[model samples]
Target: MSDVLLFSAGLDSFPAWHYLDKPPALYFDLGHRYRDQERAAITALVDRCGIEVSVSRELDLSRWEADNAIIPLRNVYLAMLAANRAERIWCVGVKGDATADKSPQAFRQISQMITDLSGRPVWLDSPFWQMTKTEIVAWYLGQGLPAGNLLLTFSCSRTDSAATHCGRCSSCLRRWISLVNNGIDAPFETDPWTWARVADYYVPAMRDGTYPDHRAEEFFAALDAVGFVPPPPAHPATAEDGQR
Candidate 1:
């Protein structure tokens, strides 16, 4: 068996793809709102690379109503499915981003469980376990992976049949913030939207107890905890200078 990857076709997963050099990629369609777009983006990414990597799809529909973005025990199901095909499986989990099914403890227990259940040595690997998504994007670029290829990947949590990003969503906002902080000129508004704008919305919401809609406040608070302050607005004349 070959190595397997839980590829999600987002910024985080791309670095794993780059470093792994196109292992067999496994895509899960767990009835997330963005599954169609994510699947399409993954197909496009593999096609663009022209690499001989196998992609397997699993459609496991769920009706859990926690968040449209979170699938209950998603990584566990993905790991279980992947273990049947490969002795080693990799997922793009990063530091400080663990959920119930994605924590270090969970992966360790799952690895042991897979070995015991399958009666073989099964390994679950996350090479980027210590890096944040933003850091992974930076690492990918530093490795000379083309930014244009990355632009084709999708991360927005909410999109329509057309696969257009809803700019107001927390995922969209996080994408924008991460790219800007890493000095990537992602195809977004050229107008100077700042962390200050996020604060202006988040502060009052926290006071009135309406802040954590879909954990938007928590997301922004993490960014703030990392000490991201808004930069000063540049002169309007230089806005379109194409300097990134």
Candidate 2:
């Protein structure tokens, strides 16, 4: 039986492709926003690792128009789509440390709905579901994958062709801080934006009694443990500068 990946060509999913015991046979593309870095990274990953892909199945939603990171039930819809195409295990790279609010519970809820709707058993696998970014990166490094390409995977929610990563956005900021915490300069150093806005946004939440008590605490604590002093703010040349 073949496996399918809800592949976004992001840092989380890329290593999932590499690390799955039964390597993925198809990549379910939601046709949301596209980034050149993601495209390039996927192409390179497929070539280097010999994974197959199925692309461009549209998610018929009112185009994601808002900046709010949470899109209502996006993963659930995507998981259902993947289930239709493959009956075997369907893997998602929902990292435990990264996806604090939306990992196991979200996935379990979706799987239950899919079984009810489709009337079949399908496995929703998340090998890295309980692992931290540090653990994932260490796994990748141990596997002898090139660290250079790791930076090419895109995680930015805001898409810009010219500056594919809106470095100021929450997603980009988290990725940047994650890289810094890992003691590695983010691959997008040439981009004009810095993690100052990201740090500013969270540090206050952390200092005040506003931050959530659970995974959010672990998230911020990990950043603090990693010594991610936010840099001074700088505007990117364009929103797409570091995107991909």
Candidate 3:
């Protein structure tokens, strides 16, 4: 039996795809707004890497908000599905993440749950658990993977009508920061915002209850050194709109 990878065509999965001899991959749509964009990226990567992929188109969007693309217990579904196809499953659970499902404890518990139900020991592995996103990209670069392959990955939380990265979303911001910090000049367009403005927008929203200020504050805070804006009085009146 071969290993099954819960692939998302992003930085986390890139190294796994390169190192793992083209493991079978599974992609979940989960009714996300950027699902089409994700699929296109995945298709391009697959064409380049020659890996087999299975796509799951989700029908129900009722479980989560349309704007916020997190599905509750998504890892559980992925693990169980992977267990059905292979005894060993691979995922990218990196360091310092708030998501409870991606934790080591959660992975162990899910492995046990899969074994109990399937009557077979299913191995759930995350090789990049100890590495950060920047480290992972560095590893990929050192491996001589074409830098052009980097453009095939997508990490935007929100998508426009054209299925492009919103760039203002937390995911886009973090991806941009990771690439820039790693010395890769990413050619993606995101809405411009300074770290100060991100805090100014989210901190008050946390108080007034307009935006879900969970990752917004934390991500922007992480980008303190690298956050680049137009610098000073770019839009004094519409600074609020820049947060969007």
Candidate 4:
């Protein structure tokens, strides 16, 4: 059985392709709001790298995460679809992710469900599950590949071009945190630190240890590089404020 990645041409999955020794990749065009941008980014990357990846069309999973940035059961849908291509499926999730559908426990459960239903051995996993996005980016650049190509990867909540990211969005903020921590300052239409969430939410939340320590360390370091500072530790944002 072959290994297939549920590729999205984003920060996480793009590096995952390399970490997995360049496995065959599968991208689903869910016709979401950012599909056009995502498809374009993927096309650019694959064409540049000559990667063995293909797109599956017309599977519209739009509006699932339109209002809120979190895509509900997104990994579940992707895992099930990927099983059709390979009994061994690779879905890239990062450290500190215990999302309902993207955690290690969740992946094991998906694998069991798929195996039982198909009566065929199926296993879904994320090699980067234990690695934070910053660590993953460092690993990717450490591969000695041309770093410029990584700029082609897309991670934006709103529409973004291959060259510029909308810095205000959570996806953009996350991407900036990872890339900046790796000393790769990507192009953003607005400085990610200027995204009000950095001051109003993330700063305090990260300081209070609402996020994993490793992640918080990287997050603060990235912001510090850009001259952003958090409030006093005593005034940390409560975890109940939620991750926005």
Candidate 5:
């Protein structure tokens, strides 16, 4: 069976298109808050790259996303519909992703369910499950793809019609982390280092083992790159210090 990717023109999905051998993609305009932004990016990239991607606006999932950007079980709906085109469905699930719907277990269950119901083996998977966004970007660039094109991918979670990324949002922050670590420091509307979440949430959360160790190191490294995080104090003098 052929493969199809559930593309969103985001940091993760854009690179995934390349990783999966340029499979046909399906973009579902679910009428979310940032649909316009995402759609614009999709259009820009598609025109530039000439990739075959079908945009489906048949489903308006906006009603479910009224109070929050998160549409619960959204992946389930997208995966089921994407199976119509190809038995192998590629969804972007990164290494540190903890979302219930995007987890490995969830995909396996969903794939099996879809296969049984459709009377055919439909597999939904992500090739980046073991790789973080930063590594994914590195791989994309390693393929000799243009950085300008990847920059065209949008990862903001804001509702504004801004020309730059809202670097404070979780999506934007993660995007910044990936790009910064990959030696491509794309500009954002607000400096991601100055984002309140970095100091109050991400720094602490990543430090306290809430986030994976590797991810934390990369994040700290990114912060270190811009000198956002202060250097650790000189090694504390041991008891031998008194002798010295």
Candidate 6:
């Protein structure tokens, strides 16, 4: 039996793909907006590493009407389907520095749900679950993986057909800020206010007594270091929208 990787064709998954000892099975489809990039990345990865891939076009959940961030329990469903097709061990590309809400706890819940539904033993592997993004990047580089292709991997929550990145989404913004902080200019660095817009939502909530009082100072301090001024509030958006 071989391991199965829930490959999303993003930066988070790069390191896991490189380090898998079993040459795990990689899954992908045409549903996701970044299908082209995903396919290219997976193909290149397979070529470079000689890994086995089992592609399925049957599951195209991205077209269905659903929320952008939380796509109607998509991962849980994907994991269950994948478990049936391959070995029960599944690897996901989730990192600690990304956010607390989308933490390992969330995946644990999904794993438990899948086990309950399938009535079979399954493993959910998250190699970077406790590691920061910086650590992940360093690890990939240390492994001699193509670190340059990282810029091409899409992480934007917003779907865009015109550009490689949907700069307005929280994922895109966070990624841009991280690259900037790490002194790496992202490929889609055209939008300067991407991270600034994120700070906008965060700063007001902290200042107006909406966020925890303890976090206000730390938030503002980070913004100051980044030289960003948050924008005015538009409407009450959930933490999933702004932070996740």
In the range 104-214, model 1's lDDT, one tens digit per residue, is 777888899989998998888788777666677778889877888877788776645557655555567766655655666676432224435455665455445664343
Can you give the TM-score per candidate against the true fold?
0.75, 0.74, 0.77, 0.91, 0.91, 0.70
lDDT of 4 by residue, 1-244 (tens): 7889988899899888888899999999886777788888898998899878888974667767646556788888888888887889998888888878888999999999999999999999999977998888889889897778889998887753344688988888889999888888789999989888888888778877888889788888998898876666564577876775
Model 5 residue 239 lDDT score: 94
lDDT per prediction? 0.69, 0.61, 0.71, 0.85, 0.88, 0.61
- Over the stretch 166-210, how does candidate 5's per-residue lDDT look in tens digits? 887888888988898888979898989898878877877786799
lDDT computed for candidate 6: 0.61
Task: Pull out the clashing pairs in model 4.
Answer: none
By how many angstroms RMSD does model 3 differ from the true structure? 7.2
Could you give candidate 6's per-residue lDDT for residues 194-215 as a string of tens digits?
4555555656667788654444
* Cα displacement (Å) at residue 28, model 3: 2.5
After aligning candidate 2 to the native by TM-score, how far in Å is the CA of 53 from where it should be?
A: 1.8
- The better candidate by lDDT, 1 or 3, is 3
lDDT of 5 at 121: 94
**What local lDDT score does residue 141 receive in model 1, on the 0 to 100 scale?**
81
Clashes of each: 0, 8, 0, 0, 0, 2
Candidate 1 shows a clash count of 0
What TM-score does candidate 2 get on C-alpha atoms? Answer: 0.74
The lowest-lDDT stretch of 10 consecutive residues in candidate 2 is 189-198
